[model samples]
Target: MRLRVFEAYRAAYDKSPYAVAFATCFVKGGASDTLAQFKIERAESWDVLRTVKFASFSGLQTGCIQHFFYNVVFTRAFGPQRTMLVAVRKTLAECLGYIPFVYMPNYFMLKSVFNGGSSLSEGLGDYVAEISGIMPNRSFASRVWLLCRSAGPLC
Candidate 1:
């Protein structure tokens, strides 16, 4: 049974990686939010909207963006070799470049839009505020710098 399931999954993944990833991440994200609501947040009831938002975000961001990043960007830049140096470089690139620039911006934008914001400007405002820990009008470089700074001595 397990072998059959594995083969099925492998076939699905091989056939369409992005679709499989989207489905997988969508389920995983919804499940995680459900678990967090019950266990960590201790909510009395399920938040359907929150679950939807998380699932959608995970499907789009982790599924598509992460797939592209790890498979294409990382492979092209770092090669297929596995080493400590490569690991460190990958980590640094993800943290400094991807997370700060791509991921967080998308997250904040999605969050704002999901939470009833009227515009992308509002989302950008929220992103700047969250990252810079100051006004919502900070420069782009400043926001990135502040975010990287919060990563502690690694920056």
Candidate 2:
């Protein structure tokens, strides 16, 4: 298994980042779902459909969307030659802009999936309830967000 992983890693370097990101992120997404299902949750049977859905969404978001985001932010928005301040500024902007638009929706969707609610309305209600329940911990989350935002790894 280690040998195979090593060979895959070595092989990836020859390909474009987009291709590598899509493949690896897809694998990682599926692997994560498998771990959650079989290991963490200790489920009796495989949930193949959920695993595939998670992987597809993960690949689409982490692989494809991220590529476009970086291209636009770095190349088109900020230009190629970036100063530290400029990069920091852009990163902060992205962090602020990302929460409601990207992070919240992704979080809600994934939570809805894992929650196993039968209907969209039920899942959405649960999501809203849980989010509101977490309001007390908002300070802690804010601090973590600030730290992460400063570190500049938004996606």
TM-score of each: 0.81, 0.62
Off by over 4 Å in 2: 1-19, 80-83, 106-144, 153-155
Candidate 2 is scored at a TM of: 0.62
Model 1 agreement with the true structure over 1-155: per-residue lDDT tens digits: 99999999999999999999999999999999999999999999999999999999999999988999977898789776666566666767776699878998898899889989997779988888778874455679966765554443233
- 52-150: candidate 2 lDDT, tens digit per residue: 878877777787667667666545766655566656666765666655456566667665765675655565666677767875666877867766665
lDDT of 2 at 116: 77
lDDT of each: 0.84, 0.70
The CA-based lDDT of model 2 is what?
0.70
lDDT of 2 at 118: 68
TM-score (C-alpha) between model 1 and the true structure: 0.81
